[model samples]
Target: MAEAAVTQARVRLADREGFLAWIFLTPTVVYVVALVAIPFGLAIAFAFSDVTAGDPSYDWVGLRNFERVFDDPVFWRSLWNTLIFTGISMFFIVVFGKVLANILVADFRGKWVVRFLVLLSWTTPVALSSVSWLWLLHSIYSPVDWVFRELGFIETNTYWLGRPNLAMASVIAVHVWRLVPLAAVIMMVGLLSIPTDLNEAAKIDGAGYWRRMFEITIPLTFPLIAVSALFGAIFTFTDMAVVYILTRGGPTNSTQVLASWSFLRGIGGGDIGQGAVIALFLFPLLLAAAVLILRAVRRVETI
Candidate 1:
């Protein structure tokens, strides 16, 4: 009888454990289905359809929208801009972030204060920061202009955002500034996790600081750098905030990227189908980057 009772108890305990596991997973399943799966399906449908914001009806166009996107100069230009923006911003973010992470990782005086200020740039909202940059880069009554004038850099008030070349540079500069802190924080975390013994061993073997960094620190922290870079790439690629707030894809649409172009088409130009196409172009590239990064990170972890 006692043996039978123990068997029954074990069965009940197993049942309860199974129930708890299902309960924990239920919310995640529902969330993915509702938010991601459904929206992604809708966006895909919109990409293939002739759904305009001004028109109340959508007809199945069957790849015609995509063809139109290919032919559009605006779409191509936005794609070019996005590539340039992502490339330039990623370069600065990685270089500066790695340097800053190295600095903060070392034991120093007032390190916390420096870190707090460095992080302050990223802590502020993008909209607010973009607006602030707008004012700073303005032609008249701009602080940057005033400072440059005082320094004898320029005699005239320069409208930085009004010029096409200067506007793109300004946008890229703001993006790099906004994104560097977060990248640095990510790098710092990875740096902190590295075993100190390895660094010490390298030093004892007559490896200089740069040598140690290149051979030991960088290779080990490579996964983190890739992850940080992936994040920066995605943010810079899809970012419409700085462009919208600062340039508005203006001065001949020189600063337009995929996101802003999508917004302009869907919201401003009333071409929803084309807008959806523009927005979804980044999706495949982002997914590819994410998959590659994750695989690299896993490889590092195994090593």
Candidate 2:
């Protein structure tokens, strides 16, 4: 009787969709709580306290840290740089990603090898890749400078990461380079998921390639493009590795961003409260950006 009852319950549990969903979802929920939620709560707590690397005591400081952050000129400058970094990187990432995705989805010989090569940038560890770029852009014996000279683009060392404008551009370029492959892969999935019948019908109606793309492909893949953009924005907003590794916010903090600035303050400067304040600001900005993206996507869908 007991065994029969246990088997019946097991069968009932297995038959329920809700139970199955919770079963598969439990691990993800627990993972988010443990990693993301906990860290976020800690950051909020620290932002309101006087926590520091040296002090380590959590004394309530309220809005004092916020005031200090607002007063810092570097904070504002870094914020501007971060906006430019994320904006320009995202623009190129989307445009290049779409072009690459179209190429990727096309039928051709050596397509597999092309796909593999394209994914290498995304797969490579960021620090290792950034270090290689640093070597290329280093003032002494720069291969980029030599190549430019060979091509008659410059007469001397271009100092890619030395000039303020060039440094910002280099950071954005590297960021776009790293992210475009991932975006391409994402849009490729979207493109591949699209029903082939739609394209065939359009082709039968004498729609050219560009017309089919603008009408059918772009509309269907709009959601995925937004998804990729969100991913790129999150990565770009939170990322300081490229900036730290390449320029170290050098040439007068031209490449400095909120993420790097937060690290400089919290860890490097040992002001945990102010650092948390700086880092926490990214949350709302990200949230707003995502909301706007979703709204734009929805508006497009409606139209």
Candidate 3:
């Protein structure tokens, strides 16, 4: 009878643990279903339906919305702009972030202060930061333009947001500035995780700084860098606040990216179906990028 009681108690304990596990998982499951899954389903539905602001009722339009989006040159332009923005931002974010991480990894006086400074752009609200950048690049009162004029780089204040190329460049610059800090923090983590003994052994083996960095430091840290690049690309690709606040896709829609264009079409232009199509375009591209990056990381790990 005692043995039977013990076995029953064990079963009860196992059941309790399983219940607790499910309890912990329930919130996350519910949240994803409600916020992510449900919205995604709605987006898919709306993309195929003729959804309008005045009418909650929608008719099944099939691929008509996507067809319209594909035919629009503005859609193609926005897609190209998004690619350019993401690509350029990723390149510079990695390069500068890696350098900053290397510097911060070294022991130094007031290193904490430097670290705080590095995080300023990231910690500040993006909208506020973008607005500040707009002011700094303002045509008449721009501090950057004033400094340039003082240094004779140009004779007059430059209209940064007025010209198409300049507006695109400014948008890209702000994006890079905003994203670099996060990249640096990621790089710092990668740098810190490197075994000290391995680096010391490399030093003892007569591996010079650049040689060790190129051969050992980079290869091991490359996987983490790729992760940072992936995140930066996603952020740049989906981000619209900076572009909206800075240029509103102005100067002939030169700075317009996919996300902003979607907003402009769907909400701003009051064509919900077309907006859904534009928004959905990001899904496949992002999925492809994520799959490729993760596969590459796995391959590197196997090596």
Candidate 4:
């Protein structure tokens, strides 16, 4: 009798929509808790404690770490660089991604190859791609320089990663290259989901491509654009791998950002508290960006 009752209860629970929703979400919830929640909580605790990589002990230190991070000139430089890096990357990413998405949606021959090539940068492992870029941007033996020289654009090889401005530009360029495919794919989905009837009707009404795009297409896809921007901001704010691999925040720390700076201080420099403090600063900026972007998405037309 108990076994029969248990079976009936299980069937009822499985049939319940809310219960099924949680069941489907169980893996994601567990993953987030184990990976994100725990690490974030520990970081918060470590921020207020005098923890170091050498000594794993957590000793309460109040706001000393925050004070130190505030006074560090490198921290200010990293903060500035982070803004510029994320801003410039996001601008070009969205613009180029939109253009690429338009091309992707157009009827063409051998589009499968184009799509595969476009996705290569995003799908490739970051470390591997960064290393490849490092070779391409090498002080000597750069094919990019060869192309430029052959075109009469320059007479000699340019130091892509050895100067402050050029290093920052190179890092931003690589980061944008890696991310644009993802943004393009996302915008492509939004583009595809746009109803064809709308475009057709607009064309019948004598609306040109630009007019229809501004009036109907862009309005509908604006939300997804914001979503892509949100993802870009998050990736930009948290990623340190490219910076670490390509330039190592070199050229006099010109390409340093909060994410790489935190990693450098917390792990490499062996100051856990300071590193955690630096990391915590990222949360507010991210939160603000997310809130603003999400708000914009919510207010726009749904795709």
The TM-score, computed over Cα atoms with residue i paired to residue i, of candidate 4 is 0.95
Mind giving the per-residue lDDT tens digits that candidate 3 earns over 1-303?
Answer: 999999998888778977879989999999999998998898899999988887769899899999999999999999999888888888999998899889988999999999999899999999999999999999889999989889989998789999999999999899999988899899889999999999899999999999989988888898989899899878987899999999999888999999999999999998999999999888887888788888988998999
Itemize residue pairs with steric clashes in candidate 3.
none
* lDDT for model 1: 0.91
lDDT of 3 at 43: 89
Angstrom error at residue 59, model 3? 1.2
Instruction: List candidate 2 stretches off by more than 4 Å.
Output: 300-303
Which 10 successive residues of model 1 have the least lDDT summed?
49-58
Clashes of 3: 0
Best by TM-score: 2
Clashing pairs in 2: none
Candidates 1 and 4, the one with greater lDDT: 4
lDDT of 4 by residue, 1-303 (tens): 999999999999889999889989999999999998999999999999999988998789998999999999999999999899989999998999899999998889999899999999999999999999999999899989999999999998899999999999999999999999999999999999999999999999999999998998788889889988999999998889999998999989999999999999999999999999999889998999999999888777444
The candidate that achieves the highest lDDT relative to the unseen native structure: 2
Evaluate model 1: give its TM-score.
0.89
Compared with the true structure, what per-residue lDDT tens digits does model 2 show for residues 1-303? 999999999999899999899999999999999998999999999999999999998899889999999999999999999898989999999999999999999999999999999999999999999999999898978999999999999999988999999999998999899999999999999999999999999999999999998999999999999989999999999999999999999889999999999999999999999999999989988998899889978988898
Instruction: State the local distance difference test value for candidate 2.
Output: 0.94
In order of listing, the candidates' clash counts read 0, 0, 0, 0
